[model samples]
Target: MVDFEKEAIIENLSKVINTKLTEKANKFVTADVREFGFIGDGLVSDTAAVQKALDYCESLGGGEVIFPKKQKVKLSKAGYRSIWTWNTKTKLNRAYALLIPSNVTVNFNECELIANNEGADVINLIENKNASVDLTKDSNIEIKNVTINQSIDIDTFAYNSMDSCAVCFQNIDGLVLDNVKVLNTYGYGMRIIKASNIEFRNKIQIDKCLGCNIRLGWQTFIVDKVNINLLVCSDSSNRLTANAVQGNTLHMNACSDFVIKEFRQTTSNPNKYVGSVNINNNCSNVYLGKVYSIDTGFKIQDYSSDGSNQPYNIVIEDMYTEGILDRPLFYIMGEGTKINNLRCKNIGHFWINNGKYTQFGRAILEKSSFVVKGNLPKEVHFDKLYLYNSSAAFQSNGGQDVVTIKDLTIKWDETTNTGSYLKLLDIQCKFMNIGSIVHKLEGSMKDGGNQKGGILSCSTENTLTKIGNIIDQNGVKTENVVVTLSTGMSTMINLAASNIWRDSWLNVLDVELVPVDLTSSIVIYNSFIADTNGQSLKINHSKAKGMEQFRLIVKGYKHIKE
Candidate 1:
């Protein structure tokens, strides 16, 4: 405490050299034109000085070039024009930050990197034609904690094409970007082309960008722990365009084996006129998790020429979709695609159309296959299923395909002018089980003229072995449930359980059943027929055997009325 002179000397040493040492350890490089032998800041305007600094650092075996703090370094006209043209034949070997010796970080704080004039692109990395940034040459290349602020003040009438990022990452690999924000860019956020093994962590915010958020071209990139908020909040009608117009948040074209996790995106008013995610052109082995969307969710299509064995092995799980009035939750039109554990709410339509003739929404494969479930607006002709909700639960247009449906529930609002409780057309499954409870139907049969009700119309050569009961309060009186069994061969229609209601009329109207054929050997047994008012059980028009063995137990009913 008494050594005042020693304390003053130590304080002076720390104030001069120790502080500079601490700043250097923090990786903050400040620019000094005087130290670099420049006449002034204006003379060193171009990237020539910057490139020379990088080259000098590399020539010194490996170091960092510092920029002066709180300095407004303007790029010369030649510098702005030449920034995109630096090393057009190969990637910049400067390696701003490498991984071997822990790399280097060139921090730009209170220092700006600006284009000389308006409407000029700030950075460009072209491939083959120009020099490319090859990150594959090294294991780890990191770009983090930096701010790229570009000016957008330009003439409205002047056709000056100002793009902040002309081309980003052409054929680069093993690159990492964290906490890197781009402000006021005209082009894409990061256009990755043919580069693989990349990871982007932390916050990547693109403010006032007039292009797609990000684009990946046939590359396997792992993106984890990232939060993106693109506020396309512009008053100009034309400015509010699609987030990812041509591609997806992460689009893969002919690429495979990629895992994308915990990816989130939100906008104030999404350009609802466009689709959010699009998976196209033979992209397979994709695993998606926790992908939430405000508008139309995700669409996958297999547009292969032969349409066989293309876009195979796709798995999507735990996805939530919410849209406005007229938007679908998920639209799938491809072969050999499996979706499981998908929860969707507040959607307009849900569809799964067949990409092939044989695979017309077919979801099962002869007891040795997967099961299809969940609510769908259109027909789902799957192999094995447990489905629920909407007017028609399951509709199979493809005849002679084996299908089984369990726990089927159908709901329709009478206020809406839609038709049918369930329509099963041209189905020939080995065994059919239908459990339907119609909550609402459009027009009641008591109002007559149009007999609107559930129907099971079959147009095939096989038999429908089992038919389940219908639980309705009005007792099948809403409309006549039609079950049409096609003719030519001996077919058996077995009513396993019957819960026919008090006012219900179970009409089994047969087609192509001739008198002699009916007398031969057709069997319809174990069926309860309850008719108190003598309503006829019309079994007409069929050419088959064994009709005498068709035992109908009539209980609590009067005689048939002509």
Candidate 2:
């Protein structure tokens, strides 16, 4: 026999849960699009009838508009992809477009909204006639389980709606687009302008478009609090030679305070990347998480007129790339950008920063094997940059700012086409404080191998191997120049040696230990003079310490450099 009290309590709990779930079932007055006159036959101009249904659903103070299963849609309008012409010859009708306004839910039922529409997008929401839109938090629209097909070429496509986008939004405060596929669009796959507090999630795919797959926030639009993730974009490497801009996967122009997660884009050919992902035009406070690319990973810049607009406060983490085919994996032309956990291979430039900033920092670069080249800037905050098979590292050129590296590690590869191991030129004007650097060089010292790491003199302009080759190329003494850590300040180095080549690691950063020559037994000065005129500032090391408390301050100098 069942326990009566226990069974009765379980039944009561089930009843309460069912009541709560029932509240979520079809909250809106649901009706099929066919009921309002859409044939879904793929030939008829079902524009007027479907639009009528949407208008009625909106009038119901927010209801559901359902599209029948196995629907084939083809609606025709004049000048499908033409620019706006207001003359009597070509009258535009943006109202007849598949417009979904505030407080409505659309369920496509896994149906195809086919590309039979001409002149405008097959679907639109809250069209703003002007370039600018004013939005608020009171209204919303939701769409799910739909494929927007724009099966037309530029010859048949027209710039319809507020944006020339096949799926467009303007002045929208709330929108949820889930499980949507935009295919073969003559223009942009989807365009969002002047929006705030929106969420785009769950399997959004776009393939083969003339322009960007998605364009977010026009230059004149004020946008924020937008979260987009799980977006897959591919070019198919099938763009015509006559294409323009090659169509970035997603473009964010002049947007602010956005978060992008789990976005992966791939091109058909690694060499045929046409401006893959662009986030430019004064975008700030942006974060990219779990992003990967085959072509150009990301390009962040500001091309506003007069060069006043610049991007700032950007953070990208957990980006794994095949490296870049044509561009840098991360090209930052802004300020206050932080990157973490970046993994790449032998493709192209890992990162290229061509802007000005007060301070820049990169955190946790792990599991990467490639060679990269770039300038080291001032106030760099980096930690645990473990590089394997690295061909070349940073060009430690002296700039106005003194760069203090936190921790850098280089693991050598014997197959690497060896270049300069380290480039710390003496032209550096400011003091560079490197915390900890671990270099592991591979291969034998005999047979003219490991023949690299050239450090030259500013006076003689010849290779100076004062600090005998740190690694063996072939057993032969390498004529290639070694490190010249000569700075304006004496006793500025505080480095702790990790695992190195051999006993040749003696005079690494020592004032008393002498530097040895590679080919000869010549002993270079522990601290050399700057000029032949002997008009140089000198200092004496009175204390021994570490870099955590190392400080170098140069103030009120007499004659400046020539």
Candidate 3:
């Protein structure tokens, strides 16, 4: 191994670059489309002529092939078998601007190609796999300043999930497309599969795309290092009237290390039931900077059945939604796709739809607002759920265990006008709510000692500090929690006679148990209620046997035997 001086190396490298540039300038010649009998009339078939020019430029070891401005290089409408074909090696599709061969730059400045008639992508990239080993740095394909309009549909590939688009790239490393506008695409605007280091920048806009706007990684490819900045996902007059396209307007499947800086969804095209931003199938290391949408919010889900494919290590910093979504604006489904580790900040609006969030690792939600559409999921768990000023009307479905919340805020939804499910903190500590504050114990608390009833049986499994701390950390206590029971049942927090021999501390100062639409009662442990204003604790509604005497003095309120 020999060390070279830095200055000497730079000088030699400069010399080499100058030589290469000089050689390329002399050898890489450019050709106009008209040089090969090309007629600009839209009626004539300019496929052969265009193909000749491109092949000629490529044969000269890669060069620029410029087309006349605003020329209608339309496909021959008469006696045509296929408008475009996958010309991977033999110059890519013989027609249209589909496959961009290696070391070639086609500038369609102010030019447009009317494609998407037959499920063939307007500009598709099928990399020369036989090139070099490393596709990341070895590939070279750039398409700039072009406008692609794909309006045709192939009946054969109509329902194919990953078929037809404005531009599709497959395993093409080192590809850069700038200032590209995709319009009137029947299917997706663009799709890249098994590719690496592919970038589409400088205001890439997609309009009137019937299907998905942008898609990455299909069935069996792991896409990496993709960046799409200044993206716009819009449709014209809700073109997806027949439900041909579904899921997210922008879909990311099994992709990694990608960033979508700014996405603007101008018009709200619900397409009835499609989500605006959908990321699923084990996508990792993704960051969405800012998103403004009126349609639907972002949904991160894993449709895999075996828990093998789920979203991991993802972040969405700032998101703003303009309209009130009946659905959850930001949601995470952990059915098959496990949420390993994720963090998102500043959500506009949200609601929980009652899904079993079976998370394997940790999840942190900070500075996000949870709009209480209704009740959140029944069995939901988070390592740390920190709500700064979020309005969350949530409760435990008797299945929560050891949850920790740090400084949260709650409010009412002005839309529903129907007040929230108020009564909450109804958690189950291993079938025992030991020393817990019981607001709306479903059935009567089984005389306290009777473990067989619907009452929350006190368990001595935990210490006094732990139980007290857990109840204090409940989202309600810090900001005034009122547990309003649901109507239709007469419940109780029964402090039966059997509790006379045991020591179970109720971790509440003023437990307000009121029903939503009915009047229920809780028979306290005789000394349950002490005073009215200085408000001593009270346990006075229900009763059991062998309660002879009860004496208690708390907060200067004294009570005699009952």
Ranking by TM-score: 2, 3, 1
Model 2 compared with the native: what TM-score? Answer: 0.66
Sort all candidates by lDDT, best to worst: 2, 3, 1
The window of 10 residues in a row where model 3 has the poorest summed lDDT is 552-561
lDDT string for model 2 (391-482, tens) is 32333333343334455555544544435443322213233344544555554212355545422112211111122123333234322212
lDDT of each: 0.37, 0.51, 0.47
lDDT for model 2 comes to: 0.51
TM-score of each: 0.53, 0.66, 0.58
Model 3: per-residue Cα lDDT over 374-483, one tens digit each: 12223333433333322333433333323323222222222221133322222223221112221222222213322222211223322222222122221233322233
Candidate 1: residue 17 lDDT (0-100): 32
Please provide, for model 1 over 291-310, each residue's C-alpha lDDT reduced to its tens digit, 9 standing for 90 to 100: 66555445665555445434
**Clashing residue pair totals per candidate (backbone < 3 A):** 26, 20, 19
Best by lDDT: 2
Segments in model 1 whose C-alpha atoms lie over 4 Å from true places: 1-117, 120-139, 146-167, 181-187, 203-211, 218-248, 270-275, 353-407, 418-498, 501-562
> Model 1, residue 306: displacement in angstroms?
3.1
